[model samples]
Target: MTTPRTEHLVLPGVLTAEQAAETVAGIRAVQREDGAIPWFRGHHLDPWDHTEAAMALDAAGEHQAAAQAYAWLARHQNEDGSWYAAYHDGDFRRPTDLSRESNFCAYVAVGVWHHYLATGDDAFLDRMWPVVFAAIEFALRLQQPGGQIGWKREADGTPVADALLTGSSSVHHALRCALAIAAEREEPQPDWELAAGALAHAIHRHPERFLDKDRYSMDWYYPVLGGAITGAAATARIERRWEEFVVPGLGVRCVLPNPWVTGGESCELALTLWAMGESDRALEILQSIAHLRAPGGMYWTGYVFEAVGDSRRAVWPEEQTTWTAGSLLLAVAALGGDEATTAVFGGDRLPQGLPPECCTR
Candidate 1:
């Protein structure tokens, strides 16, 4: 039985449950109609963020609303099985970009899988399978010979080598869901397992095959966060980069030597720490950042990145962000022993196509 002790949500030296809940409340207050949640009220909604927000809501037990969020995505999916990057709130009509992002499309699987686990609604899963199926097909187009996927598709269908380590890590997740959907339907999808394994291997063994943009925090931690890299290597990567980026009691910085720590990245770090079974440390990271929460359940995107006694400066606009809160809820669910986190953190290994690197002791 889980106790209601403050530490249940707090990370030892980090946040208390009351503080975490306050930030969560900030997130909940920003949900828009059409089931889209934005970074702030009056802000534009993006597909990746919307799916992430939906996952948080589902984990928080707001299943019905979360399902409606998925329904919104289904209704809006392009014939090619993609969604534009952004949409205006008041209109919710005009698309900001018609280009198809493979990484963006891949997130559908995560959202759908989370919703399914939360509710056990097979009917919902059946309705969503086609959407997931189409999206996976879209992701396959970006799969490269080295197994890391191309980043995005222009309207003209030109594929570029923007293959991000973080993006490919996400596709690894999408492939798992595609295979799960296939299994549920009793259909054969031997190819997905193969593709997933190959991609994971390229990421695990041959990091140079992809672009070397390690400056971004996502690149540093996502292999672990998205479950692509694991065990000692993952721990090593985090340890090696710890002082380079993490700001101690402040949260995670968006870039090296940048005097700012963003809530979204901080929450994501907490998630990664939780993934590594260091739940206490993960909770500590989350707790440290809870002070950023604003009224109405949202957070200012970042804080000043300065040493003790240095004057703080240039914080990003104070906004109640959907993804920021969503990431936190996902982390909380993970710490709370949610099964979805277990499956994700366990690396979703399939008996069929797990690469040699993944199976290594």
Candidate 2:
């Protein structure tokens, strides 16, 4: 239950084995009775963050708990194969009226596949097949004319914005995971493969069709980390935006002209660096962000937009976030050469929820 024990869940050089284990224990403390993982006990839970927390649980060898987390998602899924973007923390909680985010809906496949890979339990995958199938079906309803996935859908199923590059890139990874699960079960998924390959191609060749949000670092590097881009192309993209967003040793800014450095985006950038084979630099990035950690295993959402003369005092207070810890685990997992993350969420393979272009080279 201590930090040191949690550190052993990952390989050396990522966290002081002690630090990694401590973070894992922090996540363990947040699981609800229903197996849903809130950011913190009594805090609201969202599907995307919940899935990341479950993956952290699996990484910590809490297999049964991780499985229960997915079961919660399955039981709560809406009729159209999606879940609401948010949930209230209290009892008798209904959907919070937020639209079902396509990317969040798609993420379950990757989480399910990761659990299966970690545990090698075919029965678990079998149990999850229907849920995974339904989620992918719901996500696909938002795919626009160009193979880009629309960003979100209302409760009644109306589409929202044009496909977001970041969300679709994440979906591209999810689609590949779903296909892998299908392959493991010897299930036929020709359409799934076709959809994945096409989505990857769309991400590769057509970046303009997506909403322009280069303001966020996730939009800049996630495609590369998620395997939607590679070689000199990926490096070039990082280079083009590095000066605009990165703030040296602290972390990455959520947007330009903002002095804030967020642990989540910093860790994600580190993972993307590892995906590009720059593991050493990725390690440095992870190490630099360690300073952001607070008393518990939590991290501030970001540094303040304004800093004092010493740059030590934050002008505005920040929220301590679970996803910040999740992002660090994902980064550490990538740096330590964790095959599961690379295989499930990395490499050139498209994940489960993407459209046809995902698998195309």
Candidate 3:
């Protein structure tokens, strides 16, 4: 039976009342005592994925747990308002990857704003405002003249000038969320508004500014998913490469010319479709990936559909990740009309920063 809290998480062919609870529990179980949500118990945690899982908890009515996750970010944030790309799960103080990614750092705003919307906690928003502000600033400092953000900074703090389509798209979404937070607090950040406009313009009209990662499914849909491309453009973009990245019942392929389908990409694509007002297609996509669901309500990272020599088609990598489950729950939440999830992904209620004069001119 679905409780009132998880009732909105129930989706036909996606999650049942009990199953939704289990999935929520599955993510929560992966969250350590200090609020760090690693991929799994022994795996590493990245800021973006950790934030995604935290947002899933919010969608499941686990507000306190979600807040804790945000608190963890606040506690561990680097002096420059960024986080290392990957942290060892067993010891939060130990960073396995020292690079700081723009998208990864910027994502705190999305999760913070989502948590605020889900809980209506003014104090939480107030407390997280600085964290979001600093993180966005760190990312925007690397924004190129073309408006696409540089992908990351090396361990030695050298900025990588190259931008990635998927990463910039994600950063674009985060900037809007950060702007929304500013709007809520009556703190108008004109610079952020202009930066957002430039970023969106780059993502929508200046793809050349970004590296060609088109072979990855994320590059195909992230611009749309990230709200930088929408309306007819979003629909056409999805349709243009639908067959190339989507593999029907198995889920979305991680990359082209590969027999691999990943649960994270499939769920994100479903979320993208839902955001495009194609709920029926979104539901179908979600339902199609049911085969990736593992026991205990977690989902395997991906499956390799094609057999290689003596190896049969199997769940490749053989790891069920918290972020994979989180992505699924978020997609189901959007399809099920969870207001917080809808507001975040729906892109209508969120503020659109002023259009850049460069793009307009």
Candidate 4:
């Protein structure tokens, strides 16, 4: 089903070489010649999801295309060192959402570090250093008193004071990756180091500092997915909400009691499970999402099944998405021990925070 060039991309028996090739092709098909990958052919592109798709390309050995994706970010970045929350149809001339989300801005660091890890290209990292620095500077500016960063800044420059737990957790992970990049280049960002420490503290000791979105599945799994929680604690966190968020042989629910299982959230949970050393469980989770796969190696955003009353379950959202495919590839790559994927998700390889020696939060 795939040419010989794609055979090397296989992840043992987990994914047939053909499947991997088709998935890569599917992602590449949605990416523009200029390197911007949209959620779908006509859907909006957000910074965080765009980077996720780029990382998937790198995992597939499409290094030049991945670099081009980063180039697109470098070209369209605002003077304030951030991209808007969403660009309509991935067009620089048509940004649909003007909000600058902290998590969205910080995610570029993760993608840059991941690319460097995959390619070992010093020049690429060099070119990206200023971009990462500016983005982190912008993100840290929104860090509140309790180490929880504010959610976003409005289009008109008004700061949203409320912090989101899931977004903060993701930003926490990005900070660590940014620190690693700084360390590699001998750039001493003492402020970032200090801020990262405080952020981790907030995530670990003061979850109450963030806005409560406990109803969403992201609040249940993102800390572990973000590398802020690990070992016994991470396992416990997954266990605490597994029944509420996960549906056996189907996938993970986007939110409870909604009967909606989403491809992105399900794949992310699979990656998190792999990071926790539960490979069997992780594989099972990935396998359960097979129904979400479409013919072109694309995946639907989500599916709603018997959500209310006795209505039969059916796929919701008519379009397939780039980020959905991206998340699946990343999870599969990690399970297959792809060097960059494992390094990025495995918290052990990065600089961890030093918790308070003595004192309750």
Candidate 5:
């Protein structure tokens, strides 16, 4: 029997009520007592993937666990409001990668807002507001004049001026969520509003501002997934590369000219399709990745669908990442009409910051 909290997570061909509960439990099991959610028990934790897992907990109505994940982020946040790109799961103080990524920092706002919407906990929102504010500020400080955000700052705090399309698009979505949080607090941030508009303008009009990574599926769809592209443009963009990235019965390819299909990318594409109002197609995409589902309700990171001599398709990485399962839960939540997941991904109620003049002309 599906508990009310997880009832909405059930999706035909994707997840049953019991399976959904087990998946939620699997994520919970990976979360440390201090609230860090690593990719798996022995894996490193990145802020972006950690937050993605936390958001999945919220989608499953594991509100306290999600809140604890945010609390962990607050406790570990650098004085400058950014987190290291990766941390050793066994020790938060031991960062495995010291680069501070703008998109990684910005994603906290999205997760925070989603938790608030899911639980309606005013105190949690109040507590996390400063965290979100500082994070967005840190991210915006890396924004280029052309509106695309620099991808990261080196360990020595040197900013990398070259931007990535996927990272900036994700930041655009984060900015809008940050703005929504501000609106809820009755705090107006005109600067963030302006930054968001400029960022979206760059995403929609200035692909040249970003480094070329077109072979990756993320670069192909993140503008739409991040809510920076919509309507006919979004539909057209997805169609343009549908055959290139999507592997009909397996999942989405992680990159071009590779036979690997990743659960995370496939689920994110499903969410993107769901956000575009193609719920049936989204469901089909979710259903297609059933092979990636692992025992105990977790999901494999990806599969190498093209076989080598004497071998069939295999789970390439031999790991089940929390974020992969998290993405699946989120996609299922959105498709199953979970209000908070729908609201966050649908973008209908989120504030669209002031449009830059470039966008108008």
Candidate 6:
């Protein structure tokens, strides 16, 4: 496939076509030859964010680069189907975080499914099936009876008993993608289907199964963002927490009572808005964060703002990151009407797996 030109990418109100191209170039620039994309140069790579950056490359029409990034995951993945919480840039052997996070391992399915949608490359999908399957299998091993997956495993491979709402909800999304891959390959995985249903049920009906993290923006929105909660429920959830996590005329706060507006979270929220068919609101949210855009087409990780009385605010923490740019590109792609982006993020294009009753038959 020919590499996509930036002019064709949808940038909405916040980015010019040229700026969009720069963002693609910026993500490509940070990628290692081994196909790994880290947070930035000299930074470590985590599975989830690395997958996010790779998806941005695919959205930008860098198909080979995106495939390469996934190859890195396949090459470096632990035998247990997990990657450590962090891997030093370009050095898979040097793990910086010993923990094996379920959400991190689970995210590969989302990335793999998105890549297949973008390219329609059956061979690529077949080649990556083992990787996706292993990752999901490992992740599901952490799932509790109540449907919440454990947050992570200790370095010694013991599952952490606690679950986080954000992580479990995200895993529910990943499990859906994993099942889609299996179906396309004519591979029946009843266990995966049930696991997905259970996870969704846990996310929707049993928030108590996961630890309370109401103060964090991800915990508030992830159930909706991950597709476990939809329709009126999704709308109510966003509205209920709007005042807590969102900063009008600015962006989203990572945590309540914190002055930080994070680019990654804001962009994901924009996608969630788009998925709910609120393009106008999504575009506005994206526009509000234009201040995070860098000259090089990368976006700052986030800007910390403090209100010093009189409603005055100041922004700081100046640094562009690959994942931030990736997320922005993904959100813009959905707005731009990229079929794959719309399918995976906007439309219910990816399967959400079957509920328990269907699984029995």
Question: What would you estimate as the lDDT of candidate 6?
Answer: 0.86
What TM value does model 6 have? 0.94
Error of model 5, residue 162, in angstroms: 0.8
lDDT of 3 by residue, 95-199 (tens): 999999999999999999899999999999999999999999999999999888999999999999999999998998999999999999999999998888888
lDDT of 1 by residue, 1-361 (tens): 2233223344334435665565455555676566767667777777788888888777666788788889988888888888876777613577766677888898898788778877889999999999998898888878888788988888677777668898898788777766766776787677777788888888888888788889889889887877677888889989999988888888898877667888888888888887787878887788778667666555677887564465556456556677877777677767877675455544554233456444531
At residue 151, what lDDT does model 5 achieve? 92
Off by over 4 Å in 1: 1-25, 90-92, 307-314, 345-352, 356-361
Worst 10 residues of 4 by lDDT: 352-361
Please give the RMSD to the true structure for each candidate, in Å: 3.5, 3.3, 1.1, 2.0, 1.1, 2.9
For model 6, residues 232-297, the per-residue Cα lDDT tens digits are 889998998897788887789998788889998999999999889898999999998988887788
Better of 1 and 5 by lDDT: 5
For model 2, residues 1-361, the per-residue Cα lDDT tens digits are: 3343244345444466666767777766667778888766556778888898788677667788889899999888888898888887512265565689998998999899989888889888988999999999888878877777889987777798588888998888788788888877888688776667677777888888798987878889888876778789999999998888877777788777667778888888888898888877777777777668777666766776466577765723456666778778877776655556666656655344334433444
Task: Between candidates 2 and 5, name the one with more favorable lDDT.
Answer: 5
Candidates' C-alpha lDDT: 0.75, 0.77, 0.92, 0.87, 0.93, 0.86
| Model 6 segments more than 4 A misplaced | 1-4, 307-316, 356-361
Error of 5 at 121 (Å): 0.6
Prediction 1 TM-score vs. true: 0.89
Q: Lowest-scoring 10 consecutive residues by lDDT in candidate 5? A: 352-361
TM-score computed on alpha carbons, candidate 4? 0.95
Candidate 5, clashing residue pairs? Answer: none
Candidate 6: lDDT of 326?
Answer: 94
Clashes of each: 7, 37, 0, 1, 0, 0
Clash pairs, model 6 backbone: none
Look at candidate 4 and tell me the lDDT of residue 146: 83
